[model samples]
Structures are given as C-alpha cells and as structure tokens.
Target chain A: MKQDIREILAKLGGLPVSVDTISDSADLYTAGLSSFASVQLMLGLEDKFDIEIPDHLLNRRSFASIDAIAETVSAVRAGQEAA
Target chain B: MDMQISLLDRLFDSGLLIDTGVEGVYARSGTFEDVITAFEGLIDRFAGNTGAEVIRFPPGMNRAHFEGSGYMKNFPQLAGTVHSFCGCELDHQNLIKCMAEGSDWTEGQKASDIVLTPAACYPLYPIVARRGPLASGGALFNIQSYCFRHEPSNDPARMQLFRMREFVRLGRPEDVMAFRGEWMEKGKELMGSLEMPVEVDVANDPFFGRAGRLLKNNQRDQNLKFELLIPINSVANPTACMSFNYHQDHFGSTWGLKTADGETAHTACVGFGLERIALALFHHHGLDPKLWPASVRKALGH
Candidate 1:
C-alpha cells in the first residue's frame, strides 16, 4: 500500500520535490502539492483501489499525508466488507 | 477555436461588448443590454404566474455576513473582498507618496465592511432564516444581482463580474426537489425556444483544496447539481448557461432555517447565467439580433 501511494504521489504534478524524502505523516500541501494536483491524485487513487471515497472522509485531514490516505482506504475497504 | 476568436472579435467589432483592457471585464454596449433585458422579460413572462418574491441586492454585502457564509471555506480563491483607504491624514500622505514613488500603495487600504457578492442568492439565506419557519407551500424568491469572482479568463462567456438571475426555493426536501425538477424542464424549454441547442447534465463546482474533490464527487454522485450547457465558445467544451442545484438542507443547517414541521428546510436554486445566455444567442444566431430566425425573435417577443 505504501509503495502504491508513493508511486501515486510521485506521479502528481506540481509537487516541488520527490515523494521519497517526505515522511508518511508529512503534510502533502506543505510539501507543495497543489489543490489541482491533489484532485488528480484523488482520481488516481480511486482508480487504483477501485473504491469510492465517501463524502464524509473527503477533507484536508484525509489527504494530509500518505498515512492518512492509507488509513482512509483501509477504513473504506473494511466498511465495504462489512456491508 | 477559430470560431470562438471570431465570435469574440465580432462582439467587440460590433461594439456590443466594450473591452476594458482587462480579461473577463467588459462594459456592455446598449445592444448587449437590450438583449439581456429582452431575455429577462421573456423569463418574467414565463414566470408571471409563479408568485415569486422579487428581490434585488447590491453588488456588495456585509463583510460579517460573508465571513459567516462559509464561502471562504470552499472557494477562497474565487472570493473577492472589498477594500478601501480608511487611513488618517498621515497615512494618506504616505500612501500618496508611495503612489508617486511607484511603490505598492494598495497595501495601505484596509478591508472594508463590505465584500463583493460571489453569488446572487448568498445574502438571501440568513434573512430568510430570521423569519423563522417557512410557510406551507415554502418560500420562493426571484433575485438578480451582479456577482464578482476573481477568475480572470479570456473567455467572454466567463466574466470576472457578471449578472445572475436566480429563483431560490426553501422548504421540505420533497418541495425543493420538485421545484428543481420543474425548473430543470422549464429552463430547457426556454433555451430551445430561443433556438439554442442545450444539453443538461450533472455537474460539480470547482471546490477548494483536497476536501473539495470529495465534495465535488459527492455532489455529482448524489445528483445535487445539474447544468444546461450550450456550445457557445467551442463545440468540444460547452459552457453552462444555466444551472439547477439542490442544496438538501446544506443552507438550512448553515443558517438555522427550519420548515413548519421543525425539520431543517431543504433548499434549491435555479440560476441563469445571463451573459452566457446572451453570448449563446449571439453564437447561435450570429451577431445581429434583427437577422435572427423568426422563431427565435418571436420567442424573445420581438
């Protein structure tokens, strides 16, 4: 999951630096990821995971870091399984 | 496309729209004004039976109201705040000196008590909420106002400052949805009468930041918003000339608005982008309104 996230982050344009040096919990916006790029990244994540991110989980906190995104994905997947 | 450039050039050449040397800002010529007025009159005739409370708000609203509206939360980039020079004598002199020296003088201006309205119906909510619960049939308002946004684009259809004519309804979930549905069909018919081919599809706002992406998708998936699009500028990328949105208790929760049964009042609005519609007319019928098709002219009551 972490490797996939890293690949997605690297592909997002407008990120000032490489995603490797940034820690999992580091803020993506502070790392220079723009809103447009974040949207692109969101679409990419949705495609890769084949899971729809619910409205409630769509916020700055959810995309603040790779770790946050991984948690959201896992949570959504768990909910799907329960359903 | 070459057609778009030619259409824009024709509008400028015919003096229908006087360019202001700035992208997305223009002074409408008398002919342009006439077309807008005609279009509005046609809307009025169509809505004559509906007892909509007509209201007109100034281009700017109270700054405090703006801060509380949560507009900055979603569209901070497009929001425009009014500023003025409220400094004393010494500060004024300093500002003048800075201007003379070709330095930044605008920094001396402070934020004013007013902010340019981003949407036509923004100021209506809190006022309506203050009136307590809505009546049995719900509340309906006909509002028109000049809205300002910071989007500077070369597309004449998209202006930084433009007028929006909106009919806002607040009531129960079913009532608001019904109203939106009725208007969705009505808006399409109105456009067709003008001989403009329009397509209605679910759409989303350009929300702010990462959360905005989610909100946009949620809005689209839930079918909260729909737009009447026409191929004005380009056939490939049509522009939205009118929009129908269902804010299902979003404003009710925000403004403490309630229905007669004490539940949060659901809200919906049908907004017509006036300039875009006029531009669509020009695009479809060519530069001359007089030479437009007889069906279109009769539709506009020519």
Candidate 2:
C-alpha cells in the first residue's frame, strides 16, 4: 500500500523532491505538496484504491503523509466491508 | 435580524441609500459617495508613496481568463456570469412573448464572453503575465473595481455589488509575506485612527462543497488568510472590512508569472472593503458625517 501510495504521489503530488526520498511519516505539505496538488493527489488515490473517501476524512490529517493516507484508506475499506 | 433590517431601513430613509426594489442592490446618495471618496483618499495618503502602478478595470472581465483563475472550481456558489440575449429576430420575438407571459424570459439568454469581476485583482494576473518576467524588485499594483457576488442579504455590509480597493504584490515568497505583514499592521493603524474598534483574526474563503472542506482546512492550517474585522450590523459577527491573502505560487503557476530570475512568483494582496468600511464608520459614529468625531473627520478630511 505504501509503495503504491508513493507511486501515486510521484505522479500527482507535484513535489520538488522524489516520493521515495521522504519517509512514510514525512509531511507531504512540507515536501512541497500544494493545496491544488493535494486535491489532485486525493483524486488519484481514490482511483488507485477504488475507495470512496468519506467527507469527514477529507482534511489535512488524512493526507498529511503516506502513513496517514494508508491508514485512512484502510479505515474506509473496513467501513465498506462492514456495510 | 431586527437590527439588520432597521439599519437598511434607516439608510434608505435618510437618503444615504436609494432603494432599487432589489435586495442587496442600492444606489448610493451623494453623501454616501462623499464618505467613500474621503476614505479612498485616506488610503491613498497611506499607500501613495509605494510607487505601485495604478490600473482600473470594468466590473466585467473576460470569461476565458475567469475560467483559468479556477474561481468556479472553489466558489461556484458566489460567482456571477454575464449573459445576453443573442438570437435571431424570431428568438427575440419569442423572448418578448415569454416575458409578456410572465414566464422565464432569461432562459434563452446565452452566456456571454464576460463574467462579473469577482475581485479587483482577478484581472491583473493575466495582464501582468503577458508583460514577461517581473523586474528584480518585483511588481506592485493599486487597483479598485466594482466586484459582484451572488449572495443577497439584508445586511448593508454584505452587498451583492460593492467596491473593493486592493494592493497586490508579486515576488518571492518572503517578499510577499512581508508585504502582507506590513499591510496587516497598517490596516489596524488606519482603522484605529478613525477610533473604530478592530480585531485581526485568521480566516478562510467560503469554498464550495465537500472537497472545499479540505481546501478550507488546509488554508486555515497554513494561516494563508487573515481579516481585519469591525462590528457593523452585528456585534457577534463583525464584518471583514479588510483581508490579507498569501497565495504562494498559486497565481504564479496558474498565470505562468515568473520573476527576473525565472522562478515562479509568489503573490499577496491586501483588500479593503470600501462599502463595508463606510458602513462601519456609520455604525460606530453617527450616520451624519458632520457629527463624527473630530479626529475621525480630520483623518478622512471630511
């Protein structure tokens, strides 16, 4: 999941540095992810994971880092399965 | 709500505002115009020496540029586009007939190539970008325009059509931040000179929809916007008379704006809500400018 997240970030994040250069807990915003790019990243993640991120999870924390994003995707998938 | 309606009624009754039978739209009387003019002069006295280029644009801007600005993507609810009845004589006849029948005559109106200017600075970026790279010292501009929004309300401060006076800076991120910081202080001082109580607080634009929630949160978390608030119609929710925004490379990337060194330029703008400021003066002082405090009068050259 983390590798897939890094690949998506590389394509859509518009960061100045490589995604692999940053750790899973590294702040994406600090790594040059812009508000506009973050939106694009969110869309890319949705397409890649085939998961619908709920409105409540659409915040900075959900996309703060790769770890946070993976956790959010897990939670959404869990909710989907339970339903 | 009573106070809001009463204030609107009083302005209409006192001839300060002429009723046009439409909510959030009114004609300003000579007295009201005078106050706005004086306040503008005061602003000039403060920023005139900054050597900023002065530009004025009509209330409508090119529709293509408006689309490029991405305003619709964020605040689609507040945007207003200009439309016209562009059809043959047969269609015109039908339009007239529809209007005569008290039906939706505007349904046939086609979207024009122009949209109402959302803010004073919206039209500046493209013009600046067309001029090539910025100078080493960057660029500063003084602009004022009649802005439009779709929100209609009884609060005099929240007009559907109003004037916004803005000073925009384009350059490095540090310089842009400094410009906003300087104006934040200058804004408070300018308001203080009029003896009006004020507060500065972080703010975010009313972005639209569920995706907008993320944008709003990101903006607030980064402290990208601030507003100088003064009580006007309601004390509980003071009106934002002035705003300072730091668009770090957003406009630069969108407009292809570049610095002398070929780097993406950061942009910042400080905007003063002219009508809202006038309303605040009237709310704090007496409606009659002649009865305002001596210091306030002197500051505005009233």
Candidate 3:
C-alpha cells in the first residue's frame, strides 16, 4: 500500500524531488507538494484505491505523507467493508 | 507577464489609469469609468427580464457580519478590517508626535465596527436570513461593491481594491443550478459579443491551508464553480473574467436561510471581475477605445 501510494504521489504530486528519495514518513508538503498538487494526488489516490475519502478525514494530516495516505485508505476501505 | 508591464505602461500613458504611486492601487480616468459603466450597462441588458432585485451595499460592512461569514477561517490573509485612531487625548498627542517623527502612527489605531467588504455578497445572506424563509420563486439580487483584498502585486490586473458585479440567487437546488447554468451561457455570449475569446472551465477558489485543499477539490469535483477565462496578460495562464458558482446549501446552512417549503435554500452567484474585464478590453482592443473594432464599440455601447 505504501509503495502504491508513493507511486501515486510520484505521478500526481508535482514535487521537486523524486519519490524514491523521500521516506514514507517524510513530509510531502515540505518536499514541494502544493495544495493544488495535493488535491490532484487525492483524486488520483481515490481513483486507484476506489475509496471515497469522507469530508471529516480530508485534511493536511491525512495526506501529509505516504504512511498517512496508506492509513487513511486502509481505514476508509475497512469502513466500506464493515458497512 | 512581460506584456503586463507594457499594458500597465499603456494604461498610464493613455491616462486610463491614474498613477497613485501605489503598486496595486490606481484611480480610473473618466474614459475608464465610462468603459466600466458601459460594461455594466451591457450586463443589465444581458440580465434583462431576470427580475433581479438591485441591492447596493456600502464598501464597508459590519465587522461582526464579516466574522460570521467564516471569511476569517478561509481567507484571512486577504481580509482587511477598518481600523481608526480611537484614542484618548494623550494617545492622540503621541500619535501626532509619532506621525511627525516618521514612526508607525497607524499602530495606535484600533479596529472599528466595520471591515472592508471582502466580497459583494457577504452582507446579503444575513439580511435575507433575517427576513425568514424565502418566497416560492426564491430571491435574485443584482449587487455591486468595491471589494478589498490585502494582496499587493505588480500585476495590473490584480488590484487591491476592485469592483465586482454579481447576480446572486437563493432557492431550491434545481433553481439555483439553473440560474448558474443560464449565466454561464449568457456570460459566454456577452464576452463573445465583445470579441473576447473566452473558455469556461471548472474552477476553485484559492482556499487556504491544508483543509482548504480538500474544500477546493470537493468544490471542483462537485462542479460547483466555473470560470470564463480570457487571456489578458498571458495566454498560457488566462485570467478569470467572470465566475459562475453554485454554493448548494453552504450559505443557507450557515445563515439558517430556508425556503418556503422549510428546507435549506441553495445559493448560487455569478460574478464579473469588472476591472479585469476592462483591462482585457484595453489589452485586446488597444489603449484607444476609438481605434477598437466598430463591432466591439457597438457591443459595449462605447
């Protein structure tokens, strides 16, 4: 999940640095991921994971890093299954 | 961006914009004023039979209303408040002394009851909410105001204080959506008549911070906002001359605005960036209005 999320970020993040240089816990915003790029990344992640990120979970912290995005996707997917 | 420098120079040289020695501030010449007036008249002609109630508010609005509008949470960086030197005699003396000494005299000023209006429609919702539920046909308002943003920029198109002509609709979801749709088309038609090549595309407000990114994306994903963009300075990056926005029930929910049927009223607004449009006209049509195409002049009633 982390690798895939990283791949998604690499594709849509528009960050200055290459994705491989950053760790899963590294701050994406600090790596030059802008708000518009983050939103694009969010859209891309939603498409790849096929999970709807609820409004409550839509915050900077949720997309702060690869690990955070993976956790959010897992939680949403888990919620979908439980439902 | 390079062309903008020459355009600004032309505006100043043509006396269309009076230089105020401020980066983002300028006074409009009479011809400039007439052009905006003609543009507004064209808007009126376009909106004919819409039965929109015309409401004009002062440039400043109640500070409390500004706070209640949640503008502070969203775009605090752009918000401007009215501050005055409300001090005692001794403080006033110190203020004078500071001014004479070339010190920060404005530091002695206190925040007043009003804030420079951030948008034309910010004051309308509370007033409408106070009137109870909307009528069956909903409400349509034609409002214009001098909006202020704290942003100071060298770009001539980006003025700190500018005018926005907006048509606001509040009612059922379908009604509001239809209103937005009709204006989006009418806006395109209006620009077409003026010979301004434009494209309407989905847009989002420059929402602030991390949470704002989500809001912006949600807005675009829901197709709530559309902007009619025209190339004034740069073709690669066009400017939004007009915007058609459907707020769904955001404002209604915020202000407890209800429909006659007792449900939250949906709201939408179409705003024309008056100065930007005028700048685009001068940019495309040249600095001289007389030299403009006869059709463009006729369309603008210039």
Best by lDDT: 2
Please give the lDDT score at residue B291 for candidate 1.
96
Per-residue lDDT for A5-83 in model 1, tens only? 8898898635889888899999887897754566777778888888877767775666779999899889888988888
Question: In candidate 2, what are the lDDT values of residues B1-302, reduced to their tens digit?
Answer: 99999999999999998888888899999999999999999999987599999998899999999999999989999999999999999999999999899999998899999999999999999999999999998999999999999999998889999999999999999999999999999999999999999999999999887678789888888899999999988889999999999999999999999999999999999999999999899889978999999999999996
- The C-alpha stretches of model 3 lying farther than 4 A from their native spots are A1-70, A73-83
Give residue B82's lDDT in candidate 2 (0 to 100). 93
Minimal lDDT window, size 10, model 1 chain B: B209-218
lDDT of 1 by residue, B170-215 (tens): 9999999999999999998899899898999999998886568776
- Which of 2 and 3 is ahead in TM-score? 2
Ranked by DockQ from best down, the candidates are 2, 1, 3
Query: Could you tell me which residue pairs clash in candidate 3?
Result: none
Candidate 3 C-alpha lDDT tens digits along A1-83: 88889889889998899999999899887898765577788889889999888877886778888889989999999998999
lDDT by residue for model 3 over B122-196, one digit each (tens)?
999999999999999899999999999988877888899999999999999999999999999999999999999
Better of 1 and 3 by DockQ: 1
Q: Which pairs, if any, clash in model 1? A: none
Candidate 3: share of reference interface contacts reproduced = 0.18
For candidate 1, the TM-score of chain A alone versus the native chain A is: 0.93
